[model samples]
Target: MSRTTLTLGPLLYNWPAADWRDFYARIADEAPVDTVCIGEVVCSKRQPFYADVIPETIERLERAGKTVILSTLALPTLDRELKYCGSLAREASQMIEVNDISTIPALAKRPHAIGPLINVYNEAAAAFLIAGGAARIALPPELPLKSISAIVAAARNAVIEVWAFGRIPLAISARCYHARLHGRTKDSCQFVCEQDLDGLDVETLDGERFLAVNGVQTLSYSYCNLIFEARQLESLGVSALRLSPHTCDMVAVSQIFRDVLDGIREPSHAMRAMRTICSDAAFSNGFVHGTNGALYVLE
Candidate 1:
């Protein structure tokens, strides 16, 4: 099987600015990822807290021989948010990942990659992005195997990546659930989301854990695990596996995927190792298999 490169996706939670800085500093020195995406893709309010550290982090990662990509906000609503997206589009240090259509016009002529948050479910969307100067694309997590194969076929010459790890980001809303749960509006959110590093878990009325709320983004309850399907992904011509960051042992996680891709370890062994590091959340690969998003099938 051909080796699939690993990519460390941007941090999704609103961690302390110092914690955020330390995370990337460690990743630059230790993680085995080919690319590291840096920027705020969630709430725009969180950007100001760690905005100054972005340049240094990117420089540090670049110096360490890691490719850096700037990710745009997944859902831009305010005028300030649009301006921030434009600024990111005009950036010259690294390539930008378009997470929302609002960013497309600003990034029209520039070379950029489409992030998973943007809906690229069919051939038409994939072709449109490629025509608009998309050099690479990370397909949405909800896309099934058939759709993935079709999109890959549609963009045969362009680089294709998938959200192969972490909790699948399901949706983005204008209202902050964290604020809503606290009886506060988005403007008066009071930075409540920073309390949960992994996000606040939501459960169904039956007491079944269902999803998680992080500011305005909603994530799947189960961590998307594809350790057992690494070879299958490579067979489908997938070029990269995007591993979203969490407050866990990411260096070891990256090494596990690296060893599996390098043929030094088996999928079963990698699965066991992952369980040891992952927080007590269920694992699922059902969305990729064309079923409910939370089911996992072991081959």
Candidate 2:
């Protein structure tokens, strides 16, 4: 069997333009990831700040022998948002990842890929998309191993990717929680979400750490760590593993995962190295085991 491909998912945060550019520049030069997905998937408001920077970033990544993919918005509601996605699908040279069902029409049966934000839960759904010309489908992060294995078994024509790392994106809302937290409406509030690099952590009234808030996106506080499950996922015929971007030392993070996937380092040793790389990250693998998403199951 071939080695599983490692893909760096799009940056979901709103960092300064320089920071964003520098981050990708470094990834292009140093990260071991085989694929890199860029473009704003979180908020349209954040796009303008780094809009002009994307082309250059893509050029740099492609020059580095990486397959680059442009991702559409996960939630495109407004007419302008819809129009922008339509245009991107019709014009972009690189392969695009469709994050919303609305963008499907724009795809025009073109050879495109599917993002995790789309609700593809079964083999039939995966087959329907592959027949529609989808080259690959990044399965939703919340799926269990059984569902994933079944989908992989049936969709032999398309590459099936698993969400292997980063905080699981739980839900997205029409309302901007970041603006509301700062006493401003979605329209009036400044881009306050940019302040939180990863996301704003939420806790219960009793002080238990809960979820995270990023503008309209609610995510898990615990970062999803699948280092222990990489080999198993590959065994189940998973074609690729996606590692979402975080503000932490991601190049080191990718290298560690690459070593484990390549069988150069044991998962336990890599887990220890990961602690030093992302000390604040609370590792979780329960979702793969069909348990609480926040819990880490070693078996």
Candidate 3:
């Protein structure tokens, strides 16, 4: 059986610089992933805090036999943000994963990656991206398995990736929800998003867990768990599983997925272990099954 490649997606939360460095360092030395995406994928304002540690993290991951890729911001609005994406596209030594389409022209002729944020819902979109020099494409998490299969079949040559774990990113906004909740505006806010490493929970009127709020990104309350579908995903032509980073033990999470893919552990056992690691979180496989994004569907 062929081994499915595992990838560490760029961290989406505003974690401390030291924590970010340590997390990547541990992943580089311990995780069994094939590729590690590093850089700021959320707000560019948070980039300066951890920009210095990225180079060292890249060096460590590369030295450990991991392909390191730089990720562009998911929503590039400001002039500086556009410039940052341009810089990433210009980096010759590393492959860049563009979360925003505005970074495409800058990466023209250069081999680049299309992040999950890009709306690649059809074969035409996938073909366009592949023709535009996309070497790899991480499909959006909300896509159903049939859509994924079709996209995978259409994107024959490029490496196809799926969101295997972590909170599903739902939307990106111009205003900061975290700041608004804390009674601050997008500009005047003092980085209140840093308070929630796993994202601030957004509950419903009845106090039920509903969504999560980052600076501007809105995420699903339940974590998307695909441990049980690893084999089926590989059978459908998915080459890699992109694991979004959270505050949990990501190395263990990667290991569990690796074990399941290798046929060394049952999905049930792995799911149980994962629940233990992520005690407060609920699991969801609904989007993959063509249902609601928050419900867990057992097949």
RMSD of each: 1.2, 0.7, 0.9
How many clashes show up per model?
Answer: 0, 0, 0
lDDT of 3 at 148: 96
Cα miss at 278, model 2 (Å)? 0.7
User: What is the TM-score of candidate 2?
Assistant: 0.99
**Candidate 3 structure, TM-score to reference:** 0.98
lDDT of 3 by residue, 120-237 (tens): 9988999988998999999999999999999988888899999999999999999999989989999987999999999998899999888999999999999999998988999998
Order by TM-score, highest first = 2, 3, 1
Score each candidate by Cα lDDT. Answer: 0.89, 0.93, 0.92
TM-score of each candidate?
A: 0.97, 0.99, 0.98
Please state the error at residue 45 of candidate 2 in Å: 0.5
Poorest stretch of ten by lDDT in candidate 1: 1-10
Question: What pairs collide in candidate 1?
Answer: none
Stretches of candidate 3 off by over 4 Å are none
- Whichever of 1 and 2 has more lDDT, that candidate is 2
Best by TM-score: 2
